[model samples]
Target: MNRPIAVVTGASAGIGEATARALAAEGFHVVLGARRLDLLKGIAAEVDGTAIELDVTSASSVAAFLDAVPKAKVLVNNAGGARGMASVADADEDHWRWMWETNVLGTLRLTKGLLPKLIDSGDGHVVTVTSIAAFEAYDNGSGYTSAKHAQSALHRTLRGELLGQPVRVTEVLPGMVETDFSVNRFDGDTTRAAAVYQGVVPLTADDVADVIAFAVTRPSHVNLDRIELKPRAQASASRVHRG
Candidate 1:
């Protein structure tokens, strides 16, 4: 039998990179997509997978990536991040717009573009990496949280709409994973980023990757609809132990 294929977005780093590696280890031919071609190439080389230049915010780039990949049995929609930390009143309109573009619109566009292929696979799985912010909001989290909420809603709708179809939709909501997410959101403010998870045992990218792999590897009859993985120190979005 031919090996199953998994396509991972944001494959250049963090959970996306780790998930791609995990899927490959689980005997899936992985297709990595990200804007950083050099990083994507390196990751693909390490995982023995294919790499495609993808900027999720760009429809043409996303279309090109999907066109380049062979039929995929699994799709990891993990290309998203917050842009800045500013209260809604003070938030820059551009930053808010960018967040919506990348976090909400991008996910929808890519998922729609690949829906046909996934449905035709007969045993397809979609694992969307959402965040606790989807359920709980925080100060300066207006734009980011709203986008996540939209993404989660999309997953739920897909699950309900695909009922009886072989396609499985799972949403993974993780809290405080140790990654460049905070740093990037803060525009490389290492101090602020470090403070976000201070004294807290944050989730690792591999932890989320493990869950993603498990979700996709389950037998066709088993569909894990929703998973919430939080660090022990993180009881909720607003409550984090910094001691």
Candidate 2:
């Protein structure tokens, strides 16, 4: 009577936290990973899931996280964020480095680490949470955009590479959801963060989690390669309609 294991990174808050709850409701024994151990533990307690401290940007941390996961049926690569919005001409290397490491390399490490376990389960699924920036470029967003593009490419490539295998790879491209993303990008500027969602309603973390839950619940023969979701006010990364 054991439930399938689903490991969700960044499960401390936002989409990751919501997804963990959603999956748990669907009867999966969730393993929540994030650097925020206090938040992670609290959420895990509520969801009846395991809380493991994980810093996706660190190789040793990823290795240790993987050690805790003896087996997994699903892995959600959701631990990533933007650092800043400096223009290309004034781009901060530090910002770019963090973006690349977290979004691009982070996905690679987690997916590669769990692929064996996923495949062994006979119905493995890899869900990567990339941004709308993955397919569109916007001004002052080169670092975030580039990292998402690379992350998307990595996830998409697996669809073809693991075609004959039991593993399924799905890339989720989300436009805008109200979360700590903007606040973090602007260095704790809550004013700026609130402005991003003002005048126009944005998607909620639960909205995206609903999609992830749906994707994984589908039949084994049905593979959802890519899922792009956005609020009605958003048309693209740089195009959002405001009242």
Candidate 3:
């Protein structure tokens, strides 16, 4: 209760869930946010954190969530996910729009809402969970890659804009992370999701969470701009050493 606050979006699953648990262990009074209040409550209870029903796409929801938490030193933007695997020519525009709204605007909403609290702490940190898709363009990954790329730009621009402020921005880009991400991306096709990681040792939510925690826990004088991580089975967005 005495430690500074750290808020995490999409805290019900995957990297967000892991980040909440890991941040709690790092002495932060973690606040869990997501549309699924039930799931958030479970993780919040386990980590001794606060849970709120936060739909980042809604301005009112984000405002309400922030108004409840007055003090935040860290904010982890992890609310977005990939939607489909169709190439550009066959891609669905709806999916593309959804990705952009969630990944770009959602993060923007929370960051803008919580900036005051974070700055007040005098050691604010914003860690965005982007992906290798942010940097690499692959066939069938155009929409996702576009969204992530925009998200990456947001992180970079924030870093520049907040240079004189107390906040530091960091982007955690992971490759081939084995999470519900694949399943969700494939629209609940469990078999297809399983196949993505079948023959390769992909990174886990815990692994990325570990990196996130490390970046924010550094000496107050040091700011880690970004951290790019991947499993040994992956080389790039298109290169995977599948055995």
Per residue, candidate 3 scores C-alpha lDDT tens digits across 54-74 of 998888999899889989999
Tell me the whole-model lDDT of each prediction, alpha carbons only: 0.91, 0.95, 0.92
Which window of 10 residues has the lowest lDDT sum in candidate 2?
167-176
What's the TM for model 3? 0.98
Model 2 pairs whose backbones collide: none
**What is the Cα-based lDDT of residue 27 in candidate 3?**
95
What lDDT does candidate 1 reach at residue 26?
Answer: 98
- Which regions of candidate 3 are displaced past 4 Å? none
Instruction: Put the candidates in lDDT order, highest first.
Output: 2, 3, 1
Q: How does residue 125 of candidate 1 score in lDDT?
A: 89
Q: Could you tell me the TM-score of candidate 2?
A: 0.99
Model 1 TM-score? 0.98
Task: Choose 1 or 2, whichever is better by TM-score.
Answer: 2
What is the Cα-based lDDT of residue 68 in candidate 3?
94
Cα lDDT of model 2 by residue, 1-243, tens digit: 299999999999999999999999999999999999999999999989999999999999999999999999999999999999899999999999999999999999999999999999999999999989999999999999999999999999898899899998888899999989899999999999999998989999999999999999999998899999999999988788999
lDDT of 1 by residue, 1-243 (tens): 388889899999999999999999999989999999999999999988999999999988888887887587899999999998789789888888898888888889888888888889999988899999888888888989998999899888999899988899999999999999999999999999999888988999999999999998888999999999999888998888787
| Candidate 2 lDDT score at position 205 | 96
